[model samples]
Target: MKRLPPLPALHTFLVTAQCCNFTRAAEQLHITQGAVSRQIAGLEDHLGYELFIRLARGLELTAEGREWLPKIQQVFDLIGDSVEQIGAKRETLQLKAPSCVMRWLLPRLMQWQRERPDAPVKLTASLQHGVDFQREQFDAAVIYGTAPHDLPAALHMFDEQLTPVCSPMLLKGAPGLNAPADLQQHLLLHPTHDDQDWALWLKAADLRLSNIGSGQHFETLDQAMSMASHGTGVAIGDWSLIGDDLNAGRLVTPFDLKVKTGLGYYVVAPDRPEPSAKLRELMVWLVEQAHTR
Candidate 1:
């Protein structure tokens, strides 16, 4: 390894320069601003170059700092990743998650971060219908379904059923939505899929409407949820996702009707002789955290 400066100061310098604010970096590092300032000053003395240009407003990286920032930051992140890998713990785990589960998992992931601070988590979403895990370069993926998935590396996680959700404002504004037939008057969000999820829900509810026409189409559940939150239309979202929204009062399910999706969340990975350690740890964590409903 190349000779390196003291880690604490190096970390302080990198974080501060990235934020362009000593105080903000200190807050993020959970250290005193004075300590952050001292570290940067020490790093400058060791390197014999000022890394920042201090202004009355805040700070800006010097030319030298700008050149060095990316390299040093990548090194710092790699160090963290290395520790986990060497320990047989985990380094970075790239995950392909359904947009719905992403919202639910992200908030709860803070607890996991606290436990394994060194683990790098790379989360991305999939909108491609019936994803090909290997082709996508994901270590593991969480998708909605229980069918005979073609990938042998996949493991079943959780089954989530569907529910109707709309902004509370919509429900409160229009009392006529108490019956399923009243959906004719409201906009409904639709996703492009081989399976029409909302249509199945309507059938389960035994309601007939003149219009099965799509009101607004979204490529991802997250976008659909956002639109519904803005009171644009009703969203037939899975509770595993929209549950938090429903609980937080952003949305409400005025009707009790819900349906079992033929699809649920599945955890998958690339088939190989041996998978990376980080991927394995993440797969276990994902299975343990699977939501039941």
Candidate 2:
């Protein structure tokens, strides 16, 4: 077996390469600038090649150093990810979901906490619609898609029922939205840049508007729904996600029609022969809540 370079020197090199300055790297490592210089020198001598090109302002990586940075980064990332997975809290179930599901998921999570205080759940709301169990530490995730074929185990939460929603004030105002064709007079709010949600609903409704592509776009459905609640514009919202807003009269569906996009929200878990009892209980509870709500 070949002898490896010192771990400390490799770490120092990684930090220095990232910072591109010995002083900054030393400050981060809480070591003297001289020590940082010595470590880099030792590492270069061991490798028999210059890793950095000293510059007037700071430092620049040589061709060799640039190539080595990503490999060294991957090595540290693997070590960190492994340590985190092994040392993670076992009792608390880490759950991830997209921001759009917060309206529906948050209430149920609180209810779950109240009902079963012994089984704790930690939630992480992100813009991402999917999770990678191999790379992430989450125990399970709520993903929005047509199907959960990629997951080892998944439970259907609810189908995505899309319809136009807006504040009650908009309905009572002039340029009234009484029918699908009336949409031409009002501003449209889209959850995505492509306006796919609105397009899908429109296609289902068998209504074509000249300004289908024209609208204010948002990165997430949550943003578009929030704007709609404030009477900014008519936003295409998911029926399952906007139930609370509708009940509270914060937002209202102008038309009685709803279109199912074939896509749905599902609670997915990593590949495992047998999942924990708590995980199964939680997934079942989520499905129940979706049905009841």
Best by TM-score: 2
Mark the 10 consecutive residues where model 1 has the least summed lDDT.
125-134
How well does each candidate superpose onto the true structure, as a TM-score? 0.61, 0.67
Q: Considering summed lDDT, which 10 consecutive residues are worst modelled in model 2?
A: 82-91
Q: Would you list the C-alpha lDDT of every candidate in the order shown?
A: 0.71, 0.86
lDDT of 2 by residue, 57-94 (tens): 99999999999999999999997796477436448888
Cand. 1 TM to true fold: 0.61
User: Which regions of candidate 1 fall more than 4 Å away from where they truly are?
Assistant: 1-90, 129-136, 148-150, 193-195, 276-278
Q: Over the full model, what C-alpha lDDT does candidate 1 score relative to the true structure?
A: 0.71
What is candidate 1's lDDT per residue for 1-293, written digit by digit as tens?
A: 53356555677778887799989998998756765776687578768889999999999899999998998889988987975666465456667776567666675565676777677676676544346754677667776666545777776666667777888788778645777777888888764432377888888988766656646665556656766776878777877666567777877886887787767777777677466776677777767776432
Looking at model 1, residue 260 earns an lDDT score of 79
Per-candidate total of colliding backbone pairs? 2, 0
